[model samples]
Target: MPIKGSSKGIVGRVGSLRGLSTALMLGVALLLVGPVAAEDFPLRDKYASVGVPPVETGELAGSLDAMTVVDARSPYEYETLHIRDAVSIPLASRDFNESVRTLAEESGQPLVFYCNGVTCAVSYKAALKAKKVGVKDARVYDAGVFTWAQTHPEHTVLLGEPLQSTDQLIADEAFKDRLLDEDGFYARIQSSTDPVIVDIRSQDQRQGVSLFQMKDRHVPLTNDNRELGGLVQAAMNEQRPMFFVDATGKQVRWLQYYLDEQGVEEYWFLEGGASKIYEGMGLQ
Candidate 1:
């Protein structure tokens, strides 16, 4: 009924229409469901993520799953507040390692060590100790309880009397050149020179072991060494000396090394043990 040219043109148009229909259907199907292709990140793949072998600093910030959070703090501090289910292991105990080994033997979990915070060195020391005792998976949570409290206020934190490191005592200048021995510390206390006395021993020693020699201005350095950040920041705010005092001068020396890394000014320390203070007081 149509001319030859017209019929041929119609057939060609019909064929084009069919091809377009097929292409649309295919596109729609792919859009609805198809395998997603992604380009691989060569650098990330090579590094094996952030928390893998030969590097551990990045690992400590990871989730708490499957980890045994060891609170390397004093028992009284531990009782006040700690991560729920965290095992208390005081750093001052001679049998600290034994306790850790027993805990590991009982539960056999990965260890995450924590104390006061960045300023507190006990947690780092404890982590190093943990690493020595076949707990290859141990790492330090340098933030400690203070950071934890800051970050997780919704969670419960045990409260108790505040503790301060012995270094703070020497920094105060009242306890400068004073012997740190039992007799020396008490004599200074009796003199009421208003010396800031800091006892580095664990809570057990403070309550049960022996009566503190100097009760004047006593600051208890809690197990949560991370909280000591407040002290450091406060010192920085006040432009006060971040000094050191301990049973021996060892802790202050270590603190000096740490403060040096922080670009802190010079910190002082007593040359002899605290006992020399007693002798200086003529009480030794």
Candidate 2:
């Protein structure tokens, strides 16, 4: 079924497939001249995984002993309920920087960042700020408090914090894996009102690419299709929706995790990399 948004011409549809099939989900809205045909669509029955490098649940359990786990949720959210020992440093607060700096100086341990949930980007923003302040290790717990609630129900959760378990999120029939389809990617782009589409390719690679003849503003993530931090930041600034088109699913997935940490709610990547988008345009 197609989900409608505020845009002029865009539609998102998740197919009728069922039961834990690892199909990458791509939600795209397109305005094409003719009855557009999607060829070589990347989305299939293959699951696409997301989020931060696995923090050993054991490591996470042990982390509470010697490390400071900072919750980047707002004060109201914090006061309602929170995990045991999780300090509040709302990303929206004026004192966020100061609080983080003070913690870094006093504690002398790497800071672990978390936000409300997987879709929330607060922890990623917190981690970026922590890195700037010279905190040696600023790891983002991408799952955030929601996932934490699922995995560690024994831990105290802040009152009013919405709870959606890991099983619920992962098994969520609606959870769309971004690595799946060409049309799905377009649906994601259509969802955003004014998305900053980032082409995370090298200068040379970008020069060699084109997206549906609908030229989008692109920022090179590397000189030779390498590091992706620049593109990551560009996507993070988007207030509406954002899209990152890369050379491979691997890099795009990483970018999604980074964006997730920043608390970006709506975001996506072009499936089959940049070339696939072009190929659909009949451009090789």
Candidate 3:
């Protein structure tokens, strides 16, 4: 099993607290390679423990046709951005395994499934599922679409357009600009005359319990994004400052592209998203 990103696990802590600031800076630089580090997301460990191997990003980059690349994320995410020539076969579909089988048989190529990044378990799970269904070679590209897009713009697509320059992709700094902690989110609500909050959680994720007492408008970026389109249009039309929260804050990365593309000027995302907000709320 070859893992590319963060190939080496953290070996050990510093023996002494000497030069701690420099060490901390180096660690921060390493971890920020993605939205979050693999250590923070245990699902990567969970799948790897069960025997799913990750295809190195550079290996895939060197040989794009070595395997049939599959986007294990939702079609919406795929539509927003994806590796050029990668097929979208979201893991949630009823015939996911069957679809993998068809592609494998037709192309006679190994399969590599990838979603958001280290935070996402979909790609790992998708590969495991493919193996269970007897696909010859199934692997994961756990580094995912974001890294791929940034790594090779020539191999990237954004909003149905070939990404001509890396500048077209959103920068980490740009995303950081709109990202807010729980306190910042609360401050925005408290300071606003009429805070237009938005909950982007999926219906199933909400579990029929409103995170914001059903007050915040619910508009998720699902496969069918008509509702989300309406919300974006309204936000653009009204020039309202909307605060958005998702299940785990990862979705907002994808949503931000849409928001920025739509020219929505004022918006903020709740870091750690609805999950953290719930914990902050101290609800049962």
RMSD of 3: 11.8
> Each candidate: what lDDT?
0.43, 0.51, 0.69
For model 3, residues 108-129, the per-residue Cα lDDT tens digits are 8788888877667889888989
lDDT of 2 by residue, 14-110 (tens): 1211111122112122222344233311211111232222233346777776666777764433433356567666676666676777776766766
Better by lDDT, candidate 3 or 2? 3
Q: What is the lDDT of residue 67 in candidate 3?
A: 74
RMSD of each: 27.5, 17.7, 11.8
| Residue pairs with backbone overlap in model 3 | none
List the candidate 1 regions with Cα displacement exceeding 4 Å. 1-62, 159-284
Query: Estimated TM-score per prediction?
Result: 0.40, 0.38, 0.78
| Models ranked on lDDT | 3, 2, 1
Top-lDDT structure, candidate number? 3
Q: What are the runs in model 2 whose C-alpha is more than 4 Å off?
A: 1-56, 160-284
